[model samples]
Target chain A: MSYITGPDVVKYACSCGLLKPISHLYFCRYCFQLRCSFCVCHEVDSNFCGKCSENIPSSEARVKKNRCGNCYVCPSCQQELSTRIASKGPVNPEDSKSTPKKMYYLSCQFCRWSSRDVGIPDQSTVTGGWPERENVHSNRLQELVDMYKAIVLAQKQQKDKDKKKQRGKFLSYTDRTGVTAAALRKRIGLPAEFTHPILKNKPKEPEPASAKTEVDEVPEQLLTEPINLMEITTVEQRLLQPEAQPVTVDKLFPVHKQLSIKRSLRCRHCEHNVSKPEYNPSSVKFKIQLFAYYHIPEIRIVTVEPLRAGKQCELIVKFTNPTQHQTTIAFLKLNMDEEDASLDSEVAEVIQDLDQTLSLQEKQQMSLTSLPLSTSQPSSLISVPSRQPSLTIEPRKISQEVNCDIEVPTSSFILPPRDDAAEYDDSGDTHNIQDDPKLVKWRKSNKAFIKLNVTPMSDLALNSEVVCGFIMQHIYTNTVASKEPQKYNHKVKVFLRLGQLVGSE
Target chain B: MSRNNIKILPGALVCEESKLRGDITIGSGTIVHPSATIIAEAGPIIIGECCLIEEQVKIIHRLPFDQQNKENTTPVLIIGSHNVFEVDCTVESPKIGNNNVFESKCYVGNKVTVSNGCIIGAGCRVTEEQILKENIIIFGSKCQMREGLDRPGLQTLQMETLSKMIPNYHHIKKPNKKV
Candidate 1:
């Protein structure tokens, strides 16, 4: 349970400069940059019912107002309602020919709310055929909509006519020939001017509605009787049906379950998918998942000594390499400006060129997915797909304050690649590598516990939390963009909250 | 510690591996699984018919610190009919009503009184001193309570299957009294 609700002690700084745990950040392989939800573009991949896991086509979803047709939720509790069969007794118990049809009703398991509570009759078929309520003012609302449309069309027509009249900088043939059209019309005995025929088909305005003098007053029966508050619906219950906002419980109706969508996250800078789920709704696997945890070394605090202001404290943290290739980790000053200028430009340019040729195979696989849309929709009504301009968010400054200083280790450590079989084997360590005994506390397969000396600033107040940060630079191997893997140093800032400062020793 | 004074009614299935202490009565048709601990430390515990006490469930009747010195009163823990104490759940409630389900890994403290049709959901810990209203369903990690319209369905089929399956695998403690 602490995996989800626990306090995040270890955080990695994203390329966008927000501090988040490794799982929440996405790794964009194309740009080799960390992207969080704030920096990524989320697009709906498919629409599906969460309860039934049935994928609904985008066009069908639009027609149904983005609601699942077969699934429903309880009006009282807003939980998925299951269809339960009610087997009624046969009309004639002894008669051989008599049979009873099974009736089905929607019921919520959590609150045990049945459709019969709201007077909805059971259906003979399993699929829902629940009665729908029609809005009383729909016709009047449609007429008002048409009136507004006609008014806007008439205004547009007048503006077009005015624009045509303004465009006569040069004279016409009739004027250049020393005879104006009006004077020539009298000579030829023609009509004064032919009005633009297209302008005659003008939109007509509807009659304006007048307000009624009388308003709805409270009924006489309400004043005489005490209201039972239990029988009335609460504000949350009423708001569930915004169209009706039923005040009484008896008027409650089963609501169609809203359709859920699976979204794919794309890096806004490069327009490449960072995380994409499989097309099947039931499949829990992802087609493209570039999580930072898969590519970067994970760090967790193991133990720390008592913290005092102006004193050096020993802090131990465990580092684990998750990738299949061995990587060397080095500690550097937590300054991003110096590192950004000296690193990554040449390697990034090399990768970007290789990505063009390497992405040809994946581009075809991604382009073949076309959701079949029914052709009955008119060509004009179907919205044409237009290219959306890619958006890039400016990187923000890191917000965490480091109140403690860390002594950067001069020597770097090498972490072996992850081995699945080593977890089950009971054999002792076989790999021989020289290590700095003062820095390395312990070592195992793909994991090591390292020690560091941290000193809290002298001016910090007693009982104030002390946080320390450092830069962890690791060699990242990129094998996807080329046949031969190219290695580049990837630097990430890490922060650790080293408890609170106590009294001075 | 007091001696074991267990009275198993006819047709009650009590496995030999279960740990039952002090004065206790197992009602007819009740199935006590192996390793279920029923420690009646304060007073007698009377369990009703068709109760399913599964493996690793601890039904303890522990008296409070002040009540241990008093001689006049010994609070009896009474569990009602058709109640299900699922696996690894600890129930020390003073009173439990009929058709209640204590789901797996939940802890019901001694001060809480579980009323009829109450469901203490899986992994929930209810330690407060309050009487749960009828048909109250407490679920989720936060123990959010809602009033269910009706009681949860009984585990009749599960009990029937267990009755037929358990006797073949474990030794049964036969009922001393006849129906």
Candidate 2:
């Protein structure tokens, strides 16, 4: 649990070369590689109002400028404003039998800011139609937008005509003849040109705004009067109403709460979704979550002896196999300077070529594999041809320097597959696999305690932090696309902080 | 550090489930939720009228290290009227003023003096020695301070509803004072 907010004492180098906790990395089953956020394609899966939890369509969200219409945040505190109802007494005492009328206004529980403070009228109904501001220069801006659209259209058409002229090696029958297309159109009682009438003439340009040379003089009252800091608005308060940027606090208005989006991450190499959340705004579950924690063997630092410069220390680490299939864990010498991950790029290229042919087969296999995935994805979330394919981020050299050398043991260890029933069954582990007594200090059901010898560099300064690292090669069982399980070697570089080196006693 | 000497004024609803130690005074119309602790280790604690202390809230009045062995000059920690101490907050402030709010899970150290209409926001820890000005709001994890134009609105509605609902379910300590 401390890994969420604690120091990064243990880090795994992501395929993209970024050092991240194992929980933050995602495992791509198809590519058999770890993908971090940097190496994944992020797409907005859905937009929803955080307050009301109402899903908004992309078109509606665009039109509404991605803000919830009903939910308002306090301009002062930036907290969600709740609508409160106040009851009014009956106007006539004789008719006291009538129920009181209810009026609603927005209020902030944190800052005590209310809509009434800004002179906004209370509404009788709960869903009050809050007043919205229109930009004073919107009409002029609209004219400019339309004019640019027309200009772009004319430019595009001109380019198309030039392209046609260049490619027209063999003249058309009409062009070769004594008649042109325009002349034929006129002869057929149609318009001489099919171009837009606006395009026929140059696009109208809006009147340019002129600046005044003279500026308004500051009021004399400001120089003479003592200022009240309480009356003036702070930078944060003014920024909330960016359109107005009112200096006075009374002019601040409640702003609509911005919409939040759920994002789905896709693996760049395989072009497959690595993580996708469920469509419901309230549900925290994901439809496809390929977090590396579920597949990789987790390592936690159990204990380590006080490190002295050039002195050997015993370091203990606990490893747990999270997968359903047993895996063989091997330690490889850590290489900080170069990476063999570039070889994966060539492999990815081959997969990319296969993906092109796989799509055609996928269309055929769509009905057969309907139960698992890709059948329930929303149209908005589908990968479109217009969007460019995500490029894989280049792996970087592991940045942390290893000050301590870890002795790599020659023997590999076997981790039993995780069993859900083993914890409650109370029955001892029945596995017959033999473990190296010197390497493996303890073994339980699915977890093993491994001991390693580490030594801090002799040249390291006194009290300097000592870092040690090694590459872990594990057997990954791939069961996604085959009737029988296919296994492969997956290498992951892990670094550990083994506390600081002390001077020799 | 002393025997319990609780004095509840008339109209004050002090739940019997709450823990009160040493000398303490609960003013009229004050509501103390069950499980709230008011410890007066150094001296007596005088909570004013209409104050609301919610569950898991701890109001401790222990003396500072330097003052622990010294003769106490002002032995009473006076909390003002209409103040609200929300859930799970720990307040050891020597001085607290009227209309102030100590939000949920916040910690007000002994050195801090909370003035009138001030608010210590949720989860904020203010251990540094400083006097909070009127209407000052200390918020966020960094304990950033911002001045507000007005104090937070009273929790009268919530307090009114609680005063009616609490006595029906839990045992009530009888008011020992008329006012």
Candidate 3:
């Protein structure tokens, strides 16, 4: 007997006629049925690396080859054997004067065929020269051609399937308009008899008093509008077969127009080809026009904390725009390891409305607090966070300011101890250097301020002090191309450490 | 086994004391070294020219099952030219083609077709129904071609190393022997 805990429980027999726990069953969303592992047959389709294969429960064996990486076979007898580099020198090389020759072993399990009997050279024995083979076949020409053709066909099929699935959904005007008659009339023209009858009967229905009262009793909103029957209906032209009679042309050719009296002229002095030219000579001077000015933002690292395995740290990021013009920042993006590590493609977006109307500079502070810990294990002293914790917008105007703060948990950073400290201490101390009181107190009071000057080719500076590390990212905008902002993003990660004394005074 | 009377055609290799019983047709540009035996019992063994037979290679016509009944045995081993047979290689009723290189100690089963320009690397065992394509390089022999070499996701070199080794042997004629 099994006991059910938590929530309502439903028990049913599997297709294999076995009773299993609910967690062991799978719910098929398409068929709305329960499926167990035993109910369906699983086939291995492909083989991957053993480490990845074990982690991937649904992986199949690689169809191309079944053998593991380390196994090899004897070419002569088709038997599995161990192939290794034979020792060359004597057991104690100092005692023996002769050089040892390396050899390879090929032992057959069935016929007991050994390579030693044949005097074959080992792999290590031949370094530069081409090793010799003993057996050659004469009729293997057609097999190679068939293999190449099959591989090309499989790739083409996969590309077609991917294109079919990549079509995106977007709203269009045709989807909203339900013009059924208009669409049919555009495809096929209207009949002539139906149009003629409507024109002849148009004036006969409006003259009766009873019909006028019925029209007036109808809703005022519906009766007030004049309905155009021609606009509501559509007529399409139909191509009919021509009468079976051949028509003859009266004139074969038409008279051509007389040529005008024109003469081509060439410059006699310069030998240049000349044509009719319009002479418009005004005193003209070229002038350079500048549409908009671009400002480059500055980035600086404020504070960094190398979070120990059990410890937690917070990262504070600040962005300031010291520009004079009001700017609208569009979007901010962060990248880690040359790849977009954001959980979503559109991770951070900021729309800054700076006050450019008045000369007063507006500064907005955004605190990105409580960033989640990265899932990767820490291996070094500086735990490079898999993803950047902060992102800001592209500043629109020059000298407009926006500030953003990112509070990263202390558990994300893990700093490894220095390995070369043994000679300096002389006592072979193995204590964690992060436990020092100075380092702890320094991390508590770590703060950084970044000042941004959004000038033409402006530079930003960021400064911070903390046990962990800090990274600052700056994005600048270009306004030359059709009002679309081109972002030039930059980032820097810095690790902080306390200065140590080299020698005793 | 007269050492002075050993007759080797230009670019043709014959293993030491490899007693050829029946009529054998050896093509031009073939190599057969000493210490390798090619015995043709019932049917004639025809070895095409430009074929490389390495040291200690054995090509016997007699099947293992017919050892007791040697008088009623019928098995023919025909090898084509321009093929590289590595050391200690064995072929039994194998029909090989041009530009194929067999690495060290390759075991060829009965009636296997080794396509042209195929590289059978060191220690490969090819069984029946195993058809290797031209310019196909098999790494670390003992790869049985029981199923036609149509397995998906198998990566192979563009031009086989064997084809590059034996240049001017097929299609182009040149008097050179350097591998």
Top-scoring candidate (lDDT): 2
Best by TM-score: 2
**lDDT of every model, 2 decimals:** 0.81, 0.83, 0.36
Go through the candidates in order and give the C-alpha RMSD of each one to the true structure: 8.9, 8.5, 33.3
Model 1 segments more than 4 A misplaced: A1-6, A94-100, A133-239, A246-252, A336-389, B62-75, B105-115, B121-151
TM-score of chain B of 2: 0.97
Q: Give the TM-score of candidate 1.
A: 0.79
- Give residue B132's lDDT in candidate 2 (0 to 100): 89
Tens digits of lDDT, candidate 3, B124-143 = 77656566665555544335
Task: List candidate 2 stretches off by more than 4 Å.
Answer: A2-6, A91-94, A168-202, A207-237, A339-394, B1-4, B15-21, B40-43, B60-76, B92-99, B109-118, B125-138, B142-174, B177-179
User: In candidate 2, how many Å is residue A466 off?
Assistant: 3.0
In candidate 2, which residue pairs clash?
A: none
Q: Model 1, B111: alpha-carbon shift in Å?
A: 4.7
Per-residue lDDT of model 1, residues A239-347, tens digit only: 8888788998777788889998988998875588999999898888999999887988988888999999899989999999989999889998776454332333322
- The Cα RMSD in angstroms, rounded to one decimal, for candidate 1 relative to the true structure is 8.9
